[model samples]
Target: MSCYDTNIYKVARLKAGKTQEGAAEALGISVESLKAYESYSRLPPAGVVDRMCVIYDALYLAYQHNRIASGDVKVIPEIEVLDLPRASIRLINRVIQFAEKRRDRELLTIAEDGVISPEERPLYEEIVAELDGLIQAAMELKVAEAKEL
Candidate 1:
């Protein structure tokens, strides 16, 4: 089954600090509509799902994990969401490690000079570009899979 078949909306709503009435109002959607999505009685519009990501990627990921754990969702490796608990865990971990090290080094540099020098800026820019590719790959994969479903 697709995660669209699961309680991901409800779970994500809660993870996003729920406040359904307020959130629904803010999103310019009726409370009933939000409730329907959470109950799995209605498929959220693509725009709503996209907006939800802005609120909580971790929660959405957790929802994906739940769907996979239930033995109902098959992850198409190349098109998978970043299923961090699976083999993708290694890649995700590497990204996190890379980011942490980059942050530490950048902080150390800034601590010394109180500003990024032109030379140091290029190093940070390099890290940013590399991370952007890795992050975009996962995001594009998610979008691709969603389109397929």
Candidate 2:
């Protein structure tokens, strides 16, 4: 079974001390969209899911950091900083954007007609290969960064 569910999102949002409106704004989505997601009426797209993970992870880190700074006497959980410096994060984001574009282009090539043209086949394959590589690189970078911390 997939680990993703609306309840997890809701719990994380509440834990982060964010109102629905605030979380929606931070996610660059309308409140209605957020509501739909939380209600399980609509599934988030792949890109949106990636952004969701990033946003929630950031919120978690911020919460831990703030709690520690505020002199909370509670046990401080071990926190990891997955966010790299601005330049690195920007580059990683660009790679993801590029991968998404490549994926769309590959889909269009395959969906152009009932059958992929002989000429389109090679191009489609190339795009798919590159897209896989790009996405894998991005995931590896994220995992490695998290591991380092």
The residue pairs in collision within model 1 are none
Task: Estimate every model's Cα lDDT from 0 to 1.
Answer: 0.60, 0.59
lDDT of 1 at 39: 76
lDDT of 2 by residue, 15-130 (tens): 66889998898889999998887776765555555566567653343333333344555333322334456435654775777666766767775887879788778877877665
**Candidate 1 backbone overlaps, count:** 0
Return the TM-score for each candidate structure.
0.41, 0.36
Which regions of candidate 1 deviate over 4 angstroms?
1-6, 57-149
Q: Write the per-residue lDDT of candidate 1 for residues 60-111, one digit (tens) a residue.
A: 4433534444564434222244443442554466578777777657657655
Off by over 4 Å in 2: 1-6, 58-149
RMSD of each: 13.6, 14.9
